[model samples]
Target: MVDQASRMQPTKSTSPTPLKVVAATDLLARVQRLRDSVARRAYEIFESQGRTFGRDLENWLQAESEFLHPVHVDVAESDDGLTVRAEVPGFRGENLMVGVEARRLTIAGKREAEEERRNEKTIYREPCSDQILRVIELPAEVVAGKAAATLRDGVLELKMPKAAPAKKIIPIGPNMA
Candidate 1:
């Protein structure tokens, strides 16, 4: 039997991981790969359904659901900028990447399956990898270079400042012929 005081000891604490900022080009490439994979899965699904012609959308959606986990997100707008919050459970910051373009934001994460070490006989085991990709379109243009992101308690938050509108200047001088 364990003593009460020993059993109540606190566990070790670890620092939070920082999110990785990815270049727009790299992010786009990753997106393209994921799209291709989904397309293949969708085609397989279509073929499995006896070459159905009218269920293209349904097949694509089903394939997406199987390959990617759903990410719940919310966007809030203020007078000066926008804030985005996304729920990404079971993902550490180091496993996540963020990309920001003019009016688009992309978040991607992948968790590799852990190796199993059995000290004793095991009855059953199942290992799998998880991947997530989510892209959001902003209502207003943002200053992509000024975007900041943080992850805490399985939630990712981004603060982006709005871009200033371009102003056209007119010459107020006499025209010379």
Candidate 2:
């Protein structure tokens, strides 16, 4: 016999996971793949509609919606930097990737569904997988090398410090007439 209260207690070792930061080039490549998928789906939609020309935008939007899940994000700016918060429920930090550039930020994640069997016959099974991608343009430039990200409680937070403004230097020389 075990104590029910002790068995139900949550573990204290669980902590926020640090997200992996990838290069901007990698992010762009992933974006390109998503674009290709959307384009292919859009073409299929067009054929389904008898190759309609006037509804190209509609077909593209429908394709995007079908292939991607919308992510809710909030970006806040301070005098020194920017902070971004995104809702990514049911996603573990290991399943997510983040990329930051001077003027852009990208977040992408993919989670595969797991199956369990206890020697019981299955009645119905539905295929399920989750994927999300979002790219944001910053209002000000930032130091990409110093960016940091963490995921906890289904929320992802990113902190990026702003880049210093370029300084103009004037050469000191004798005045020329």
> What lDDT does the true structure give each of the candidates?
0.88, 0.90
In model 1, residue pairs whose N, Cα or C atoms come closer than 3 Å (at least 3 residues apart or on different chains), thus clashing, are none
User: Which ranges in model 2 have alpha carbons more than 4 Å from their true place?
Assistant: 1-63, 66-68, 169-177
| lDDT tens per residue, model 1, 78-119 | 989999999988889999999998899988887877877769
In TM-score terms, candidate 2 sits at: 0.59
lDDT digits (tens) for residues 93-136 of candidate 2: 99999999999998888788889889899999886677677778
Model 1's lDDT to the true fold? 0.88
Candidate 1 TM-score versus the reference: 0.58
Error of 1 at 157 (Å): 0.4
